[model samples]
Target: MDNLSNYFGQNINQKRIVVTGGTTGIGKAIAKLLVSLGGRVFVFGRDENDLNGALEVIKAKSFSGEILGISADITQKDDIDLIWNKVDNAFGGIDILVNNAALPARGIIEGNYEDWKYILETNVLGYIAFAKEAVNRMKVQKSGHIINIGSMSAEVKEKTGVIYVSTKTAIRGFSTALRKEINPLGIKVSHIEPGAVTSDMQEDSKEVQKEKIVSMEMLEAEDIAMSVLFCLSQPKRCDVVSMQIRPHLQII
Candidate 1:
């Protein structure tokens, strides 16, 4: 894809955006891409060090848009407030909200309860809190776009464990319901499912490569980031709704 042109050809610039877990992996890629396209990006993450490192990268890129890093744990209410308050005060309001933080579950039914709790809090509850807040903020402004980063595992239930599968499925439904309710308010909601991306979330395993079921290209974080930019570029009247992205090599 060609480089994204700025909002008004005034360098890469757009309205303010808030992205959770924007310090690393897919979230980081999305943040970088958005900044590249001239959008001010406010990133919230739990680790200050990681956030600073990410900040360095964005600075190195010399992104025309501003990038703010707020260290906040999404699971904690106080942290959430601090980040959102900063965002609200800085931008007045956000034009886009991307919920991309999540815990990866990779065990069988016999996995420990800790795994389940951690995943649920991060993947399900955290997303809900962020979504609720985003809705409230957007409602006041009378417009906004929300893009939730889901997973392909939501559709192929049998492939993943209980916690991961359940949260993804629930989020898909959440997006649909939220969209239905907010469409009248002109707040667009969308869920994007990405498959087989090379990121820290799947760093522990080479399972997909070992399987060797297909020879097509594996997805890159940039690909997912580009998809996000596409959704944002759409006219307010047209919502992309839901997008499921998978590597051509993988059938499941």
Candidate 2:
């Protein structure tokens, strides 16, 4: 049976999943999809209040899957350890790792040193750190999947999105290499590149992000979230090397 839960999930019941930046926008959307499909999912957020609020809503659904939240800034190395600890105890082992946490992107021209550092810490290093952590457990289990949420900007340069584009480009390179390194060990790494998704990556107020959604014809967060599910649901013998989703009429 080709289980189809709207591409978000179907046969993924009880699969352990960890999604970073899952408090809102794309990450939250992914978490919700997983919950409805009966996957045990854990997510990280910097704000405890936001995290709790999202968790409450997810739990209220009371689906077969579990949805838990951890409050931490993924940019900090120490916090990654805390997250891992939760995962170790909460689910015992991780079957899927979604490196979805990222800092907002903006123009770069004599940018502030501190801002650049923050972006790099979260967008670049954090991704590698999580994979490293997951590998320790996944190798023992002999099977796992790492899905990196990248952007189409990695392939096409966009105006004023240089820094963000560069980081995603780095992810593209890193994911390809990481796959080669870990595939032999029974782990799968995939890069889900998206174009012009309606996400709050611009650091706007949540209210504003929501208001804009009513008018925009761009891809919804669910669009990207579904791709993630598709990758995870594939047959072990079939490796989806890469999947890119672009909203209609989006040039870049």
Best by TM-score: 2
lDDT of candidate 1 over 75-122, digit per residue (tens): 787888888889889988788899999977864656788778778888
Best by lDDT: 2
Stretch of 10 with least lDDT, candidate 2: 2-11
175-239: candidate 2 lDDT, tens digit per residue:
99999999999999989998767765655565665565554535789988888888888878878
Per-model C-alpha lDDT, please? 0.83, 0.86
Report how far residue 193 has shifted in candidate 2, in Å: 0.9
Q: Give per-residue lDDT, candidate 1, residue 207.
A: 66
Candidate 2 versus the native: TM-score?
Answer: 0.91
True-structure lDDT of candidate 1: 0.83
**RMSD of model 2 against the true structure:** 2.3
